[model samples]
Target: MPANRAFVLNSRPSRETPAGPHNFRYVESDIGEPGDGQVLVRHHYLSLDPYMRGRMNDAKSYAQPQPLGEVMVGGTVGEVVASRNPRFAVGDHVVGSGGWQLYSLSDGRGLRKIEGGTPMQAWLGPVGMPGVTAWYGVNKIIAPQAGETVVVSAATGAVGSVVGQLAKLAGAKAVGIAGGAAKCEFAVKELGYDICVDHSDADFGDRLKAALPDGINGIFENVGGKPFEQAMLWLNPFARIALCGLVASGYDGTPTPLPDVRVLLNTRSRMEGFIVSDHMALWPQALGELAGHVAAGRIRWRETVAQGLEAAPQAFFAMLKGGNFGKQLVKLVE
Candidate 1:
């Protein structure tokens, strides 16, 4: 049998010392057989998300930390090369938490069989967790109304892109806050955002406020820091904030302080922080909604892919630094 190449976590990363390639060790092992009730998957794509950084630490979190001396945890879409499981068959495409490996052996628990309505890679992106995340945050938390103003940070990313489109679909003015001019332009021109502000600019706060003459009724906060803090200054009465991610804090573990304490009380704003997996029952509904939007061309998504499994570590590090444009993924197979 051909060797199964994988990256195993060798050490834990901390707030003071961030993780790097040194924390992982590459190994080659035999591609073992899958016995009865098991399936062998050959991963085609692996998702690189910000949450994986949190899993690298051994501290208490909403979920268990990634165990050391094992394959690093991640989402993957692949083909079942071998299956003794009755639910799965050879040549079947699947999506699951398959980790950072060329191949994986599974008992077919969380693995979802791909039905081919949408593109396969999208199961890791727009029609998948990111899409469901956007749908839930916008509809359940942010709850934008017609003609209201909604804002999303990291506007061109997988989740943020979908967030903006969904807000627009709700008849709200979608405002995007992204890193550079190029992304800002894409948010407005392609994603149908009303106005997209460049957060990297020196006068970003002023520009953001200027773009929102009506103030913010809803916010899908992906990157919380100075950008989110600036956006907070213009919260409208009874505005809603869906706290999806704090990209900066997730990496280094330093909290970004938003000092405008009185706004929540003054505006009666509601801020809800969520983990998408917690609401398992809502996923089917949310995914169906998202897939329909995608089918109708109401939702647009993008991806940035790295070449191979060996490049997963560096790609992940780059993605954390905002080097990626949309959904950061590694193409594990040709």
Candidate 2:
């Protein structure tokens, strides 16, 4: 039997921001065989996300803290090599909360068997959590009308990219805000956004204003801080803002200060924050539409894959720093 490689949370960060390699320690262990109702899964891909940063802390949050000495929590798509459970068979593909490890044993709770023409990795990306997240924010929250303008921060990321495309599908003009010139180009050219403003530019506010001349009717906000503050300046009357994430404050585990409430009051705008899991009733509808768009080549996605289980720690840190483009995942096995 081969040993299972797992990245465990060895130490908690002393500060709120900047998670470093010292926080995680990789270890090899013998997981043995699955129990009577369990399945042995070998991870093929692990999803790295901004939310995991919050889990690393001991502070209270929507989700429980990641336990020290346990495998770092994450979503994984993998193959069932052995199964004692009747629900899952050997060689079946599954997506679940498998954590950061080469192998995991599951009793089938929260595990979903996936089989499709789409690549398995897509189950962890655009057609998975990120896609559904974008759908909920755009369709349920923002609800932009045709000919309206919608601005999305972190435009090149998994969620933001999908938000832009969904806005276009709704007949709205999509404007994106990204950190660099290359990412801005990708958002506009590849993702079909009407315009993309580089947040790192000296005149980013001016550029965003120019791109949205009619004022922003909707905003799918992912990155907060200065970018979010700038977007608030262009809100039209009765505008909608879906607050998805604050990646700017994610690293430090700091609370993102709310932008001036006066703007919301003056514009009669609606801004709401959401957790995608809270809307589980809509998953089937969201996934079906996202899958259709992906299969028909209507929705475009990109990935920054790091090979092997050992690479999970560095990959996670890199993702937090915005080093990866699009969806960031760790390829645990071939």
For every model shown, what is its TM-score relative to the native structure? 0.98, 0.97
Candidate lDDT values, in order? 0.90, 0.91
For every model in order, what is the number of clashing pairs?
0, 2
Cα RMSD to the true fold for all candidates? 1.1, 1.3
Q: Model 2, range 215-312, lDDT digits (tens) per residue?
A: 99999989899999999998999999999998887547666787788999999999999999999999999999999999999999999999988888
Range of the 10 consecutive residues with the lowest summed lDDT in candidate 2: 13-22
lDDT of 2: 0.91
For candidate 2, the per-residue lDDT at 181 reads 86
Model 2 residue 314 lDDT score: 85
Backbone clashes in model 2: 2
The TM-score of predicted model 2 comes to: 0.97
Off by over 4 Å in 2: 16-18
Worst 10 residues of 1 by lDDT: 248-257
